[model samples]
Target: MESKIKHLEMVENIIERMAKNCFTLKGWGITLIAGIFALSAKSTEQKYVLVAYIPILVFWFLDSYYLQIERKYKILYKNISAKSESEIDFDMDTNNIIITESVAKKLCYFRCLFSVTEWLFYCPTLVAITILIRILNVF
Candidate 1:
């Protein structure tokens, strides 16, 4: 029983770390975008606005990757909770869990890319950049 508790604690810690990573990525994404915007404004160069797309897309993908893993770990936590103490082997890998739900299918890379949280943070930023590019006559 104690070992099971320890195993759960470990998994929870991983989930927390993944969440922090996603948060950090979002922060960095915004920071990079802001920096790019500053550069564009200072130089009056429209190219920097377009360049902002690279970090936004990269961070979006990276955030989705972390979110997917965090979700898998959440599923792992549920699976672990249902097991008998003796069944707990302290294995942290989430790959063995057979994904069954339609929602769980969103855990895949491409699907996660459009996940609500991902879209909420990134899409607006992209739109803002696009609008800025248009205003700058970058086309």
Candidate 2:
């Protein structure tokens, strides 16, 4: 019975680490997307394309802001997990709470990335609609 509890605790610890790593990658992804958007905006000449990029800039801001929050929670989780490591019987409750909060932080970051995609996806369509309206006015 004691061994079983130890194994479960080990699994929980692994999960906590995995969640932290995933959030780190998500932060990197956000940085990449922001760089790409900024570069594209700089290289483009057309006014409509330039206008289209404003939303992406907003996405960049959101990504960088949340990345900071995720990093803080990750450190907090590591400290809590380390402090719990010496217990003989394994305190599952504290581990669960820390891990759950870490996962929640990751999920929030993921959600922000999704929001960025949604905004980017619709922007081109919006530009197209505006162009179509202008063309219709010509006829």
Residue pairs in clash, model 2: none
TM-score of 1: 0.92
**Model 1 lDDT tens row, 1-139:** 8988998999999999999999999999999988988888888565767889999999998999999999999988888988899999988889887567885776778887898989988999899988888887877
TM-score to true structure, per model: 0.92, 0.31
Give the C-alpha lDDT of model 2: 0.49
Local distance difference test scores for all models: 0.88, 0.49
What residue pairs are clashing in model 1? none
Top TM-score prediction, candidate number:
1
Candidate 2: residue 7 Cα off by (Å): 0.8
Instruction: For candidate 2, write residues 1-139 as lDDT tens digits.
Output: 5554554556456556655654564455445544544554566432343343454445445544554454444444454545543443443343244445655655564454555443464355446545743653422
